[model samples]
Target: MKVKSFKYLLTSISVLILVYHLINMFIFWPEIPERIAIHFTKGEPDNWGLKYFLLVIPLIGLFLWWLIGLLTKHPEKLNYINLTEKNREKQYTMAKEIMILMQNLLFIISIFANESLLRYAAGMENGVFIFLSLFLLAVILISLFFNLIWAATLKE
Candidate 1:
């Protein structure tokens, strides 16, 4: 696939994962909704702190994408986005990798955290967990290849 199309697909996948995570937080992690209300003095570890941190990965990935669009304008059929510098490409690629890694971690967690997601659908027993884990694992594997590809392509 072309770089642009691949990036679009990745963006879509990342967004979906992020949304799923957010919804999971609401459904399973009671600590999530009580975040701001949670008192540090209560001595409770931040509720679902890792999930919150995981959520930041995709947000940062989006920010990097938006930055690349704003800074570089090289696509032949460029829309409102632009990416003129090589560093921007590298940065975006790095952010994408980080996002994928974060997602894979969350996917694994969801498999075990039944309250976060119903693993069993139709009595299949956490079918979504099984499927999502596989999907996220595939994404992570592909991302490793892309990481090498981007590194090679961006070489001066």
Candidate 2:
């Protein structure tokens, strides 16, 4: 399969954004390592500015999955010469498999983001990081678990 045209486009955008953010975090950034100043300044916010820089991949993954779901579930009813319910169902099954995989990966990323690796976003506040991390973790886990279990609900 050609992987669908719209999916290719969305995947390309996702790769681009992911690269940009990774470069911004690892190469172009000037954050003070371990709260230690290596220059004339005291220090930075421990990479506060770049904590959430590389989160675009998950967003793009979501859009691509949605596009795949729509295309597979709603192929042109008259375009195929021998369109059958079996073929349509097969396409929908493939799309659901792919979408669930995407959802699982996204949820895993969210779980990692809830760790200290990207905890500087909310600053050094006492409960800001903990609160937001737990909230996001819960949301991603719940969404992925439920959506995967209820993939049939997406049939149209």
For lDDT, the strongest prediction is 1
Q: Write the per-residue lDDT of candidate 1 for residues 60-109, one digit (tens) a residue.
A: 54565555454333423322123446556545556544443544344343
List, in order, the clash count of every candidate structure.
8, 0
* Model 2 Cα lDDT, one tens digit per residue, 21-82: 45545642344233421112233433233233434434554565565456545545323323
lDDT of 1 at 95: 50
Give TM per candidate.
0.33, 0.34
Whole-model lDDT per candidate: 0.46, 0.45
Cand. 2 Cα-lDDT: 0.45
Worst 10 residues of 1 by lDDT: 115-124
Model 2: CA > 4 A from native? 1-3, 27-30, 35-85, 92-156
What local lDDT does model 1 show for residue 152?
Answer: 57
Candidate 1's TM-score reads: 0.33
lDDT over C-alpha atoms for residue 1 of model 2: 38
